[model samples]
Target: MLIQSIIVGLIIAAAVVYGVVTLSRKRSAFSTKPGCGSDCGCNSGGKKLPS
Candidate 1:
């Protein structure tokens, strides 16, 4: 019973740590220029007509 409880506690701790790491890294994964990472051509200064 004690071993089971310890295993459960460790699993919960790992989950919490993973959640924090995911949230912390989210900002760095984002880009201010929506088109900079793609070849969508939206980053070009020229205006695009509606298709």
Candidate 2:
């Protein structure tokens, strides 16, 4: 039916919009920081470890 098709289309559009917003938020959060995020596991915080 036409109503069923319209509902499906709306659901798909909503899902796409939600994904875009989530990704943008994550990108902005990372960009606001200077170095890599804390969870990067790089252990390179500009400090030298003991030899």
Candidate 3:
């Protein structure tokens, strides 16, 4: 029973870690789009779309 508990604990820890890593990798997408890239006029024309 102790081993099972430990295994469950590790699984939960791993899930938490995975979630943190995924969020960190997507930090860029979480920010504003800077109102279009250098080769476009979509976002720079006026009000930007929902992010």
Candidate 4:
């Protein structure tokens, strides 16, 4: 019984940790600055191209 409880607790903790990490990664991924990278479809160093 105690072992089962411990296992359950561990699973819950792992799930919580996974959730936190996933959310943090998503937040960081969306937190892009101007001209951050090519993924944002903008020029690097925040420079504007000739129109």
- Top candidate by lDDT: 4
lDDT per residue for candidate 1 within 1-51, as digits (tens), equals: 999999999999999999999987896676445545343455664445456
Q: Write the per-residue lDDT of candidate 3 for residues 1-51, one digit (tens) a residue.
A: 999999999999999999999998799666545666544455566554466
Model 4 quality (TM-score) = 0.69
RMSD of 3: 6.0
Error of 3 at 39 (Å): 7.0
Candidate 2, superposed: residue stretches over 4 Å from native? 33-51
Question: What TM-scores do the predictions have?
Answer: 0.56, 0.61, 0.55, 0.69
Cα-based lDDT at residue 34, candidate 3? 67
For candidate 1, give the lDDT of residue 35: 45
lDDT of 4 at 45: 64
Poorest lDDT segment (10 consecutive residues) of candidate 4: 38-47
RMSD per prediction, one decimal? 4.9, 5.3, 6.0, 3.7
Best by TM-score: 4
